[model samples]
Target: MMGFGLSIEPQLWALLFAMVRIGAAFVAAPVFSAVSVPLPVRIALSGAIGVLVVNTAHIVAPPEIFSINTFLAVAAEALIGLALGFVLQIAFSAPMIASEVIGMGMGLGFANAVDPNSGHATPALGQFLSLLLTLLFLAVDGHLVLVDLVVRSYEVMPPGAWIAPQRLLNIAMFGGYAFLAGLLLALPVGFLLLCLNVVVGMLSRAAPALNLFAIGIPASLAMGIVAILLALPAMGDYMLVIIREALAAAPALVLG
Candidate 1:
């Protein structure tokens, strides 16, 4: 008796397509895209998730992987993945924006450091806020929620489906909210800094012999640190809301 060979054509196609989508999402998303994450580990994670997605969804394989139609479908999958990840990235950037505003106000804008997450030069204050947001993101299990959204997207928007124009519009509209959230996060400290600057300016004008530059910098730094400590709890709450909204928006981005 001869043993039958298992057909791997459909499974292979499903895995390839799934991997493309998952890989694209990870490339654009935060946390997973951090410079600290090794490339090989990222690839392995993507492949593993792709395998699970393909097996669970039983996604239909394209008639021919090398055909123009199949190529377009792959491109569509990639676009969907990118769109989903970009939404979260925008949301996560709120803290960075707020930090820049507060840092400039506090005279810490010049204190530059290399950000481990992005591997770029950023103000020390900005880096601190970014780390705070990152911790909040993980603490709330935002990453797992994002993965669940991506997996569910396969059911709502199967392969080969094109994203609607309205959905793109919604995403663009949704991004504006991130700026608003950032502004809210920075406002308390920014206002305090502004008032401090005004007082410093008045004192400088009133006393010619006093060294404003030396005095202002140190005072701003001390007050800013105090303000940050006072505002940390509020900032964490704001970040959680932003994260939840971003994850909520992910479905609309991919499924619509």
Candidate 2:
């Protein structure tokens, strides 16, 4: 076999080894790395990027591709990629979490629909939040930034390099921030709904025949929409935080 008219040798093996990292990350990441994306498409994307990585970085192949040591190094690359993708996965969970909080409050928690993007049946509120967040994320060119982050990973953690244990610790640690960010995003809506619930309960007590169940649902729905609109600015800020944290954690995940 030959590449670019040159005979395939040990040097070509470097590209193959490096590709495992890119492929694993792309396959596991959120947004562009979702399972909803066709496997063939994901593979094609990784291959295209791998080609560019090889030419741009001039990565050198191992002495023996099939040897035990070389295989272990390749495995290392795969682990790094998985870690990187997982970090992004955690970031994307923010919307789902916020939606859960909001949905439960709005009495919409049981209303679920299959999400085309993630291929899961999520609450309607969760699906809406996810879709809106995705649109906003794209509007900010987050995809390009993500690609840049992936490219930089090669520089910070070269192919076949062993990841440090602290990096794993860092990945676990970042999960704490996920909860914080999710709660912050959902707080305003949650609080508003909580107030609405209290008012509805008080009204039901004053007039038993008013049928609280019938009145509360529409009230909650309208209140939820108004609350969401009011909270939009804060939600955007929370999303930015999610993105920043994900990018910051990417290196640790990839190199750990």
Expressed as tens digits, the lDDT of each residue in 180-235 for candidate 2 is 77788899999999999999889988987898778999899899999999988888
Q: Which stretches of candidate 2 lie over 4 Å from their true place?
A: 1-6, 208-210, 252-256
TM-score of each: 0.93, 0.89
Worst 10 residues of 1 by lDDT: 1-10
**Candidate 2 weakest lDDT stretch, 10 residues:** 1-10
- Give me the overall lDDT of model 1: 0.85
lDDT tens readout by residue for model 1, 1-256: 1222236666776788888778888888989989999999888988888888987885876888689999899999898988999888888888878988998988877889999889899878778878888888899998898788788888988888888988888888888877888899898888888889999999998997899889999999988989888878887888788878888878766576
Top candidate by lDDT: 1
Q: What lDDT score belongs to each candidate, Candidate 1 first? A: 0.85, 0.79
Which regions in candidate 1 have their CA more than 4 angstroms from the true location?
1-6
Error of 1 at 60 (Å): 1.2
